[model samples]
Target: MELRQLSHFLAVARRRSFTLAAHDVNVVQSSLSASIRQLERELGATLFDRTTRRVELSPAGRALLPIARHILADARAAKAEISAVQGLLRGQVALGTIQMLTWIDLPEVLARFTKAYPGVEISLLEAPVDEMIEALRSGELDLAYLACGVDELPAALTVIDSDTEPLAVAAGPDHPLAGQPGVRLADLEAEPFVEFQAGTGLQTVVDRLCHDAGLKRRIVLRTTQLELLASLVRHGLGLAVLPVGVAHQAGLTAVPIIGNTADRTVALVTRAGHDSNPAVRALLDLLRPDPAG
Candidate 1:
């Protein structure tokens, strides 16, 4: 198969409609479908199971989607890297972040990054911290902005100073205790809590907070997306612990947990040492550099 075929397949997979994928890739639907069919034929595997109303990945397709995405990403990176050798600012950077910051404004950071280096591509992937860390180590990601509290960085991963904020309790404005002056651990023991699945950074923080408070939280729901959790809170389903910044933008009442029980840190993580990729180094420098005189 050709690189273009993989690109076509990915577009189709993401949009889940051949017609829309064609518009996105600026190709006609027939050409796109032909390319995908050729790709499937070459691979000897069906990538998608289609119905008139919807398109879905088959089991094989589901497994191949991410691998295909990675391959396309690396291929694009390679092309961009070659262009950089000609003194042109070019090279792709894959950045991973948690869902909380997806709506954040980057000011000119992202704009300038793309404008000043038009040839370079920037792809952002949102996942839980575990998947982010795994992607970084596996070369699927060049850098990640994540919330981590472990004493040690992932092996061969370098940590950098990024802004951090505390995790807090968020509840709907109409919830019974929403207007309370302060929230105590004991107050929420029996409350239905919305939380991240186990092993995520914030989940660990919440678990520890409950443990230290000498109570166990009654977490009724688990989701990786903080905004979704906030929505659940707004629906009066349950309350959740989330980063203060995220909670603030989520339009929910966030009360700081009394005492020092709830807090988390956000940082930039990359493969460790000086041998880091130039694109990753450049982005880090842009984020944290000497003050302009």
Candidate 2:
């Protein structure tokens, strides 16, 4: 009828002696006997046949032994799962990021997180900033890494971490502006460009900068792949604007944008008022910079 009573029943059945069972279970013989008696009474079945010299299980006790053992095992497994999650031992986290993730050191963060919580499963999705925001709002993602101006984020999202880095102009080796210093946005007015698609954060920044400079861009191609953008710039398809780190890594000549040196802030975002799972919390803790470092 109760787990404690079932436990007592199991102990008695296994030892076939009230005195021995009580000793094995660290309980008084009288208490163990009373618990077993209560269990038999609640079930309306005799569980044991006892005499001065010997004790044996009745038919009902034999029938219930395996069932009781199974129930106890399942209860233990459930408690263990709860504890594992609470202790950050097991769980899953889904994180989203913009296409340009090279600047965030995401691989290092993930490596450390996996080392700390090996049982936790992690899924990483890459998309444009707009898509990442939508995924966060729809609960498809637990957290997102985004590159945008802080003011551009919606009110429903919360910024967890943010850092600003300079944006640079990328050009092929043979491009006329490859070695130029302090290249102004207006200088590229007549140059054809390869850029991210319209919905991306980088595209938004590009549009704003071009508008500010009063120059209409000549966009020859648009795609979501940063690698493709770099490839295009490499083969002289068109020039591109990208993060300074990304541009340098892609083997393109990176030059500073002069008059109005625009920079983008990369931020970690989560849905406002959403409760984070244990795995998500652990990752956020790791991503947070150490004050002592």
Candidate 3:
């Protein structure tokens, strides 16, 4: 009827002696006998045949013994799973990121955490910053990588600035602007640009840069995939503005927008007050700069 009752039943079933089972389970013989009596009364079946000389399993006791053992075992396993979640040993951590993160050194960042808590399994989903924010708000993602601002974050989530990488413009080696020096936005207005789909954080920065430079972009192609944008730039379809780290990782050349030195901060987003959640906290420790520093 209860896990404790089932546990006591198993101990008695295994030992076949009330006196021995009581000692083995650290209970008084009278208490153990009373618990078994209560269990049998609830089930309406006798679990043991008792004699002055010895105790043996009755038909109902024999039938319930194996079942009780299985139930006890399953209960312990469930408790262990819960403990592991608290200990950061066996739990699923759903993380979301923008496409640019696929190009960032996430493996290195993750390695620092995995080495310490290898039992936590990571599930990564790639989504744009906007979509990632939505996912985090909707509880679809346990954590997310995106530019930090939580105006749209559900009341339950927290945002922490993790790191920043400088943004730069990139082009193919054969592009006309490749060798140019100090080329302002006005000089490149005629060239087709490979841009991120509108509404992305990256595109917002690009739009801001173009606007600041008193120029309008000639977007020839738009994509939600950052890697594909880099590939298109490599093929000279158009130039792309991206984080310097991304451009470097994709084996593309990054040219700083002269006088337009823009940078975007990467932030770790998580369910608020889940700092107590071991897995999420472990990731946050890995993401943010050391507070001691």
Candidate 4:
């Protein structure tokens, strides 16, 4: 039916709460509910089955969800295409990233993007890899900058672009391993480790390396905050395996891990086949690395 009704219905479907969905679309609960009711009336199908505790999408609603998303996407793409040909790009892109990602100059990219298309709005959310992936699938995030294993990424999303960085052991300057040119995986067994939260890509690399080496590290600290992880390592609480650039920027000594595949690849990821919009394409272009030096 109407785009606003579809928008409101889609919001409710994703959030599963009329109140919260209303909050998301910036409308009063009654107005949002009325819009959904009108949509269901026009379609002659019950869109949602509500029972106070939670709202579940009815079969008809589930059937219409994808169709609705496509319609909204096409409408937005049409509007954006006309604006782009007129030399103006206008839309909001919700981007997700992991903590302490230093491989790419994101700020510089955003700076130039803003100068070029001042009409566009951008928002960033720093989260763990798994969470970002889920948000991308659910349409909460438009694009994400994250790390992927050497293996293929999940089928739900596709890699638009990527960059690689070496993962090294970071230690305080006074730590014994700090001065070493290359530290063996076995050598780290004697030292306690400062680690990131379990689902993080960096943590995955650290865990995989130790598991492959048949050695278990004694983890002294586990955290999600970058500043705290850097502080713990700075105080000699434990050694950390992180991107070499991040370690160097944090003023810690970085020692290469010996005989291991420890490179972390950070990718520019988005939902597979979700690149129809010009605004998203423009931002993705800016994010891509320049071909020429």
Model 2, runs deviating above 4 Å: 1-86, 273-276
The 10-residue segment of model 4 with minimum total lDDT is: 80-89
lDDT of 3 by residue, 137-237 (tens): 54446788776344645666677665667777788888766776646676677888888877666777678778888878788898866778889999999
At residue 115, candidate 4 shows an lDDT of 90
Instruction: Encode model 1's per-residue lDDT on 1-293: one tens digit a residue.
Output: 78889778866776678987787568899999999999889989999999999999888888887787678756755654665574446566777766565223444577877776686667776556876776676565777777776454676777766555777788899997778877887767778988876666667667787788876788789875566787899999998877877777889888878866577776777764323345655666665535662
Question: Clashing pairs in model 2?
Answer: none
Better of 1 and 3 by TM-score: 1
Better of 2 and 4 by TM-score: 4
In terms of lDDT, the best-performing candidate is 4
Model 4 scores a TM of: 0.71
Query: Candidate 4: lDDT over CA atoms?
Result: 0.81
lDDT of candidates 1 onward, in order: 0.73, 0.78, 0.72, 0.81
Model 1 clashing-pair count: 1
- In the range 92-203, model 4's lDDT, one tens digit per residue, is 6768888768857888988998898898877676666876776677665788988776355677888877888998889998998877899878766788988888787778
Better of 1 and 2 by TM-score: 1
Sort all candidates by lDDT, best to worst.
4, 2, 1, 3
For each of the candidates, give the backbone clash count: 1, 0, 0, 0
When 2 and 3 are scored with TM-score, the better candidate is 2
Clash pairs, model 4 backbone = none
Among all candidates shown, the one with the greatest TM-score: 4
